[model samples]
Target: MPERPRIRLVPLAASLAVFALVLRAVHALPDTATGLSAEMTAGAKASGIKNVVTAVLLDFRGYDTLLEIAVLMLATIAVLSLRTDPDALSRRISGVAGPVLGALTRAYVPIMIVVAGHLVWIGSSGPGGAFQGGAVLGAAGILLALSGFARPRWSSGAPMRWVLAVGLLTFIAVALLPLALGGTLLQYPDESRKSLVLLVEILLTLSIGASLTSLFLASASDTSEGERR
Candidate 1:
């Protein structure tokens, strides 16, 4: 075995060096009060949502959220791209589920859709939003897939692309809409801001849900196809 070279840290010298740098950095701090609370409050009020968290997510930092949705869509695309044909994972269930389970799943799905939409609507006045609602909707999508309810919308490339990128496209369109109307990007008229915010959230909820469900189903189906191969 070869002997490795010993590193020379010289503990006392390193400690002094670190301490000096920390002190210098601390001394460089500026004396200014943060306005985070004020900013968040104003943003929420402007957006007309009682849920400050939702306002922040879908309004204050909407661009980031939009990008996040795009990223998710991209990931789903990457996964789906692995296969050449749409039937890559057309198989929904590994085996036939009993009628009881099928009936139960059917009953459960509508309720899930209502709950998911409710969450999106209530987001303006509560701690919920498209992301939360979308999560629920995505769960419903998984259930549908398991029960052999999904019909691979991906069979048609154009519509499938729209489904995956809807959220991002909607956000961008909304932001640019204001510009077309002589307002800044994402800037809504005072009278319609609340309505507009709600509309965006609803759109986002659907898009996110669809995108997430696509990702899950693609992975599941792709894996099944691979196993079969």
Candidate 2:
């Protein structure tokens, strides 16, 4: 039987009430944040990033962003833990990809790769960055899957693991590097700020791409396993 509307409304109302309370608390603050743009703009210049928003995310509040990356990694780990067998897609691996869709994927994948790189490159100065570029790369991965690309018994081999971990490792290392130089955590020295930010963005973009693609592959694996059962 379908759920009664009133039963659904009970939980819905409770959630709404909680959300309203949180909003009220926020409203009570005399603007929880003020002069945020000015601060971010100044910091952006100092961080050697042309985009203030990007600087804020990857440099100014980098510790927070680092925690967010950790959360993403944890989520990926949780998803991987849910899979019982990684080899379930072995037979499906041999299927040939062809026809118009395959050709289209071939064409698009390279373009997406280039576009993603462009986004990352321009991100320091414009309205793009690791997340946007990573999303493009993730889309390319999906397109590849649609083109009948198959997974190995373990698609997530050492290379895959490295791609997944590189961004995080680099970020932490960069953050701690300042400590070695007597700078605070995640602080980029003025001399190398631009190069460092670019390097981190490139690594992070690749990591995000791999992480998202891994999640997609895992979901597909789960679906395949279910059908077999």
Candidate 3:
């Protein structure tokens, strides 16, 4: 007969202790909830950004957004490092795309590109942003890959690397440029606040899109290469 697995008491006790602490912390909170909607709304208005969420993300907490973008870039690098293929970006899926899939990919990819642009453009005033737009763009790339579309040869080269780095570089430059001007970090001049935010969003969208696409292609290529071996 197979032996039953034993529960490790030490680790289980540690987990229970941590859970109890979390429960105590949760229980200590007041029944009533406080919100900062008014404060965020005022901040948004002062910042001249119609979208409160955008104002909070890009102006009030710009450094956090910057770090998030850097993390995404790092993740893409990690994925690429694990890939065995040197030209992962140019690799197509293993099988030929069916007629329906090929036709749909041809039609939808352009629409997805347009939608991504629209998302980024409307992010300043609506419930969309660089991340959302970049996700759509990445999806378009994945669809193309699944449809057996081979990336252009140049996409596997330095230009693609530059595209992946541009977002983080632009963000870092913007963040430090204010310091050079004797202002605090990420503090855009009053006149160019909106413009700066828009610029950052655009560049971030491109970088995020490229990074996500690279991650997918690299992982898929790695899996395919392993199977063939």
Candidate with top lDDT is: 3
- The lDDT values for all models are 0.76, 0.81, 0.84
Q: Mind giving the per-residue lDDT tens digits that candidate 3 earns over 1-229? A: 9999999999999999999999999999999777778999998887788889988898889999999998998888887787666565444445478999989988999999999999999998899989999999888877876677745343356888899999999999999999999999999988899989999999888888888877777765444555897
Provide the global lDDT of candidate 1 against the true structure: 0.76
Pairs of colliding residues, candidate 2:
none
**Ten contiguous residues minimizing lDDT sum, candidate 1:** 86-95
Clashing residue pairs, backbone N/CA/C < 3 A, model 3? none
Task: Tell how far residue 3 is off in model 1, in angstroms.
Answer: 25
Ordering by TM-score: 2, 3, 1
Tell me, by TM-score, which candidate is best. 2
* Residue 227 alpha-carbon offset, candidate 3, angstroms: 6.0
For candidate 1, lDDT tens digit of each residue in 1-229?
9999776779878998999999999888876858588889887876677888887777777777777877877787786776555554455454455798789888999999999999998888887788999999888877776676665555335875676566777778877888988988767677877787787788777777877777766655456555786
Off by over 4 Å in 3: 1-12, 31-33, 87-96, 152-155, 222-229
Clashes of each: 0, 0, 0
